[model samples]
Target: MPPNPTSYDTASEMAGGPGTLEGMKRLWTPAWIARHVAMVVLVVGFLCLGWWQVTRAASGNTLSFGYAIEWPVFAGFVVFVWWREVRHTLRGTRTERPTPAPSATAGSEPAAATAGVRRPVRVSRVPVPGDGVQDGDLAEYNRYLSWLNANPDAKPGDYPG
Candidate 1:
């Protein structure tokens, strides 16, 4: 006789089987697709930049060789970030749950010191690394802006700029 099919078996299979791919499959939302497309464009842009730099080197500019290498590095970094973002998005829901607090030597984990800082109770945007986000005191910002204004060459000075 054939074995009986129970809800337990079905749930167990779903929890451990090919159904895990569901998150990966459903990952192709518009935003996800857009990010992939953008990543591709970024890679192509990097290749073009590298090629342009190489050609500049061929035409006798010594600085272009460094750029040729740098552009490809930029492409690799973009691909790395894109892959990380995808993986993070897929796993985020599952792994975002808070873990149990540690005791005693938990101080070794280095918690943020809030002693002098007035952090907003409401959740706000936290900047990602390498995103170049700067937000804080208005007066300091104004001072920075004035410094930039005084420096003539401060604006948009990156390689792509």
Candidate 2:
């Protein structure tokens, strides 16, 4: 079978192997360079904001103490995410795609069964007004609702139903 076009192995091979100069060069494409620049800017901005917060905290603003910790944590998170993306790129792993829903009309088997679901969900049909086929429990509930509507100020506990 032909290799999948979306596979990372194919992409790496096209770039002249993952460890080679050409493969490394592929990481500096316009999109990747933009991403790298953005990550650096965000990390630096967060660190600067953290420093400003720290200075404010030192000047006796209690609220700035929490923000000082928060900004540094945000910077760390940005670094962590950048590192993770680079690692994933080097390892050639693609993000997972969501599985499509099974077609209800495609086969004799139930859609849930075809999709590997153990139990099929049962949906009760909603009754339209003046349907002439009224369920006893539903009728009783509707009567209780009518009583509540008629006596708006009455407590729910006072409902005879």
Candidate 3:
């Protein structure tokens, strides 16, 4: 049964007009098509990897048995994320990331709730002091060098503690 035109439906009102298949055609754009093709290829590649791992496990290579189950799971996760993105894009809403709802830490904001643009992550590889090349051993090494500098008669193997 058709509803009366005066019915209050806030979502449809905000949608601006009847959501139709016209915008859904954007799903077939070249970039999206390529993404779909890549998704298919990734699934095939994962299946091949999983099969190879399974064959290895059958031949007494126990390590590959775990990997045999891993590849297909990765493929499934990729498809899930892709499906969500397609649905989100076709909704005709602003693609900017929605602000996270206020939490118990109410005043704090999420770091990168931008216009759907993600910031690149920076990875630092500096060695901390105490672990091998970090602090304590480095000081000990420096002390050994200084001790060698002072004790000219010491043999090269005679490192100071």
Candidate 4:
């Protein structure tokens, strides 16, 4: 028998409302279905055992031994099935494809300015120390010096203008 919808629905909704096919796929995967099936089987088996024992008592038949034997066998079967499902899930399926990076727009400023010194400084040519003077490095350093030189309301000796 299928699970009661109201319980499953409330459970699913609490777990994020069945947003996508991938989410749905995870919910109803073979491993998941097998686990639920095993659980239902165990519940039914136990109920049947209880009913049988009660009915035997009513009929003045001592079914204690019969129930004790049958319940364990059914329970073992259910446990074996559940173990298989757990192993299958642990082995795992449904690999996620790598998500692509978003396209950059011309209007969007790169985070270089706000990001400050931690950001990668793209020098036209990286300077090799003791390789005389690199023009690109000299140019960038001069631009920085000029900016430092001009700001009037700056602190006095902090960066000598």
Candidate with top TM-score is 2
Local accuracy of candidate 1 as per-residue lDDT tens digits, 86-135: 76676553534466554537547645454487656986589456646555
- What lDDT tens digits, residue by residue, belong to model 2 across residues 136-158? 99889999999999999998889
**Which residue pairs in candidate 3 have backbone atoms (N, alpha carbon, C) closer than 3 angstroms, thus clashing?**
129-134, 129-135, 130-135
Q: Model 3: per-residue lDDT, tens digit, 24-58?
A: 56777999999999999998999899999999999
Clashes of 4: 0
User: Which rank order by lDDT, best down to worst?
Assistant: 2, 3, 1, 4
Which pairs of residues have clashing backbones in candidate 2?
none
Query: What local lDDT does model 2 show for residue 4?
Result: 75
Worst 10 residues of 3 by lDDT: 12-21
Worst 10 residues of 1 by lDDT: 10-19
For model 4, residues 1-161, the per-residue Cα lDDT tens digits are 99787665442333323443434565477878876786877868876886777677677777665774677677767777776865455434434456655666899855443334685677768745785755888777786677767876666455643
lDDT value, residue 117 of candidate 4: 60
lDDT winner, 1 or 3: 3
Name model 3 segments beyond 4 Å from true: 1-19, 93-161
The C-alpha local distance difference test score for the whole of candidate 4 amounts to 0.63
lDDT of 3 at 67: 98
| lDDT at position 81, candidate 2 | 93
